[model samples]
Target: MEGEAGVSVPQRSRTGLRTERLLLRQWRAEDREPFFALNADPEVMEHFPATLTREESDAFAAQSEADIDRQGWGLWAVEVAEGPDAGAFAGFVGFKVPRFDAHFMPAVEIAWRLARWSWGRGFATEAAREALDFGFTHIGFGEVVSFTAVPNVRSQAVMRRLGMTHDPDDDFDHPVLPEGHRLRRHVLYRARSAA
Candidate 1:
């Protein structure tokens, strides 16, 4: 919720720390346009079913805000602080409460998504590692999970890079997706806090 009155972007971290090149922080209203652009990219949507419509993007952005308001934890937009695209929404990395399928119990999940332009730059791994640190250290989540379609090898690679181990037996069809959805076949990975 609103921790303080009239706070523009929420006081979670006014100017968050940097991680080499990327700046991981809270989302702003102005980020909607770039976020929508990234979400609508065909190449970026290749792993998923299809590109998200503008309306869908807007609703997703609104839901992200509502998620932070309700849970105090949600995906934070990522940007390169000193790059040409500085201040632009590169993508997001954070933890979310996902509705797990029957094969695996519900759990907190660490997720990441970067623009097509941001791919192959280690942005996803770096940001996701920080989000995992935040989730396990700061948020006190016992274990953080991530999932992707069976064919989404790139994302699975990132999860592996983040030190998550696969549990193929935990794989299941995505519950929210249609029965025959192409992206419905999913795999699970989990990383537990050392402490």
Candidate 2:
């Protein structure tokens, strides 16, 4: 459950499969510092619990790597394919199995986390499109889903761009979080196969 236990497709990078602007690749040991910085950013973590510590980031990165080995996909260190941060870690995008408390009808989800500096630039949408393509096409999943805190308009917008439709009725109080957590009320989005 700690690693990429439910990813059905073989993917190496969290950056993305590749678009004109981004390279979705797996995380490298060298990415730990920037990865940690992004995770520790308050604005970026605004929708989650408090920012992660460097140690927590390091441990998570290590586990992400293990997840790729186990399920062939997990969050990756994202960077521009050709830009100042092309080789640097900008953030991450990937897929994982939801914990039981996630209450997602589809059970598996495509997820992302990028630095504040990378926000509002279309990077999340682009990278996430690749993940959806991988999930629905190569991975042969019947559906793919995403979720976020009700106030996370940014991520919700990206989900819309990816053609995921909101199912407000699917919203639930996230069970894993403490009662009344500001981020506990979550909304679900879903996309089904073209086939």
lDDT of each: 0.77, 0.78
Candidate 1, residues 19-131: lDDT per residue as tens digits? 77788776788888888899888888877887988899888778766676655567777888776877667888877777645655667788888888888989999988876
The TM-score, computed over Cα atoms with residue i paired to residue i, of candidate 1 is 0.86
Candidate 2: residue pairs that collide: 4-67, 13-25, 13-26, 14-25, 14-76, 15-24, 16-24
TM-score of decoy 2: 0.89
Tens digit per residue, CA lDDT, model 2, 1-195: 222333345433333377788877777878898888888888899998789999999998888777766666667557788777666567888777775655564366889999887777899998888877776776667788888999999899999999899877888887878897888888899888797
RMSD to native, candidate 1: 4.3
Winner by TM-score:
2
RMSD of 2: 3.1
Error of 2 at 52 (Å): 0.6
Error of 1 at 121 (Å): 0.3
